[model samples]
Target: MTARPVSQHAAGTLEQALAMLAPPGLLVGCRRIETGDASHILPGESATILSRAAAARDASGAGRWLARRLLRQLGYGDLAIPRGKAGEPLWPAGVVGSIAHDADFAIAVVAPSETMRGVGVDIEPALPLPPELEPLVLNSRDRLEGCDVAIAGKIAFAVKEAAYKASFPLDGEVLGFEDIAVDLPAGTVTLSNGRRVGVGMSISSHIFALAFVPAGVS
Candidate 1:
């Protein structure tokens, strides 16, 4: 099968954006979802998406495709990342990571488990948060001041989702949107369990958000 050609311009832009949002110890990768991206899924990764629709499977495959590439950089050979019972990616021992994708892009971020206790990443369209969702996602504690008013709700929602992902592996508790609080200027999210996670974001054609819990921090 023929491989999709890489776009130098898009790659350069994504690299720049990632550098701005990634912490010092993280390895981040991004890819434009391509037609044959689903072909990258291995047997071990197939079960997770068996019940998903064709398009959803493609997105899942694209995420794993990028994830495997990042893991390879860490000296892990083409390992398959299975989905956890709660739907989180199950990374290899000694590593912590997250994968996220929207209609057009897929992103993955990884770090040594010793350096990062937990990490989560998410992507969404740059559009405004739906009116119905805004009520469900935002609360009095979230601070959106000094942010672009148009996408403020989107930012708050994305960061909260990232924070939930970062915290769930350690806490093993399912949390609601109201269970997370965000301070955009401070770039932090506080979970109801009292854990603090650092957040970073990039907004261009789409919104990309990342949350992390540093080792030794609770």
Candidate 2:
């Protein structure tokens, strides 16, 4: 509900708007979503991103096109970012990124591999997470402050998801909700084993979280 900075180029459809709002240190690209058009897919990528579900296909295809554009920024055009067995992006050597969508908006955020150990970003509608899942996600240390239960849940879930994505590339570690605790107001997620990642969360066109592990961390 709160407004975020708008880019002068954030025009056209929802996807177009987000392409202009790439997070710091990232180059984002996006396209209009379409279930019927898989034109955005490149060689060796369709098997990973295209799904039987119409909405899923549209969202994924749009993100792929955006990723390909960002690839241009990296001086590679034919690179195929397939999905791994773990359902994560198979980033080419020296490249990393994340893709996310909320409704009609789909986006890809990419950066050179040496810049980060791992990176991820996610978007959710402003709506809250379901109450029944709260006990499964909220940690004992979490302080929701004065926020409504749903909003608080959203914050925690988004942060945890981002952290998991950011760490997966290097650790290949399957993390449970309790393994990573989220601090909403502070915009951070701390792992149980003493590791922490920087997380940025906000309400722009929707709720979003961008996460990354600094390069020097092991």
Candidate 3:
């Protein structure tokens, strides 16, 4: 079997998934990366885009490309979005967004940075996280309290990650597994530092969580 290089323009599967989840004010875009397409992606990125190593060029590049299109649709045409100290995308002055990638998938979501503080989105293959991580990610209450629900800990992990991405820019605070906890019943994520963020989940061939907060509100 042969592997696809990062330059192939293979068809992508993320379009319909993104369309289904688009909200009224947010613009979303995604691509399936069979190959990294370095010729275009590298030129589109700068040295400060996460201090990324050569190996990560494809994933980061594809994710950013999708973000660019989404932003353009919202009037941020051909903007140069950089990365911050914590590896977050430094969107235009009034734009907020997030990017995520799996082995062969990448996605981005964006909204006005004024009223909408930030958009956090994450994607994971429909597989269970390893048992070892269950202790670290899932709180004991949500773990044993549930009578008999068949869900892998991956959704919780993804939700926490998404929440972290959306909340960090607003609060400008460092976050950790212990700092953020998932409330399945509430369909929300709570932070130990005193904040509750709204989260929405989508489960198909993949699992996705899109969390958002208004400016100055968590």
Candidate 4:
């Protein structure tokens, strides 16, 4: 899909909103996708391994663009983040990060491994979750106090996705939605494995969720 034009001010606003959700020691960023955004793709970052479709490549490039910038702040220069076997971004040693995008925007977060074990981020439009998927994405244990009724399910969905991404490298196991219990009011998610991940969210411009595992956690 072609990316719609987004004003730089709007992009910056989203980034600012997301920054509030970021914990100490992590860098977060977001940007609007543009035409031929795939040009940001660099050598050593394999697009073919990701997908041949131009749009997919463009989105990947946008995510890496943000990731590289974030990594640079942590004393690293430009580097390649290749796709792992399980379709996750392979960060440099001593660094943990995650990237995600919807059709219009791309986002990334990175932190030193000393401070964080893993970090996951996701961006989604501020839209309601489809009715058919609600039962699958939300569970009795999940809580959404103070969240708007219209987009509550969508926020929960984003939180679960980010939580799964944050936990996978640590646990080495795939998880179903049933395996995660989200508590929006508490800003956390608990995996069936008993790992608790801290959750942060931004509702401006888009629904942005960040999930993180602290360094000393099991």
Q: Which candidate tops lDDT?
A: 4
**87: Cα error in model 1, Å:** 0.6
Query: By lDDT, highest first, what's the ranking?
Result: 4, 1, 3, 2
Write down the lDDT of every candidate, Cα atoms only: 0.86, 0.70, 0.73, 0.89
Give TM-scores for every candidate, taking all chains together and pairing residue i with residue i.
Answer: 0.94, 0.83, 0.84, 0.95
Candidate 2, pairs of clashing residues: none
- lDDT for 117 (candidate 4): 97
Off by over 4 Å in 4: 1-3
Instruction: Give the per-residue lDDT of model 4 (tens digit) for 64-155.
Output: 89999999899898999988888999999999999999987888999999999988988889999999999999999999898889999999
| Candidate 2 local lDDT, residue 149 | 58
lDDT of 4 at 51: 84
Residue-wise C-alpha lDDT for candidate 2, range 25-131, written one tens digit per residue: 56755444555435666668878664767667666767777787888888986677787887787777788888776555666778886777778877776687788
lDDT tens digits, residues 75-158, model 3? 777776667878888887778899988777778988986667777889887688888987787875342234123445888888
RMSD of each: 2.1, 5.2, 3.7, 1.8
Tens-digit lDDT track of model 1 for 20-136: 898888999887777667788889988876655755777788889888888998999999998999999999999999998877677889999889999998888889998888899
Residue 146, model 2: lDDT of 54
Error of 4 at 175 (Å): 0.5
- Count clashing residue pairs per candidate: 0, 0, 5, 0
Q: Model 2, stretches more than 4 Å misplaced?
A: 1-24, 30-32, 143-150
Ranking by TM-score: 4, 1, 3, 2
Point out the higher-scoring one by TM-score: 1 or 2: 1
In candidate 1, residue 54 scores what lDDT? 59
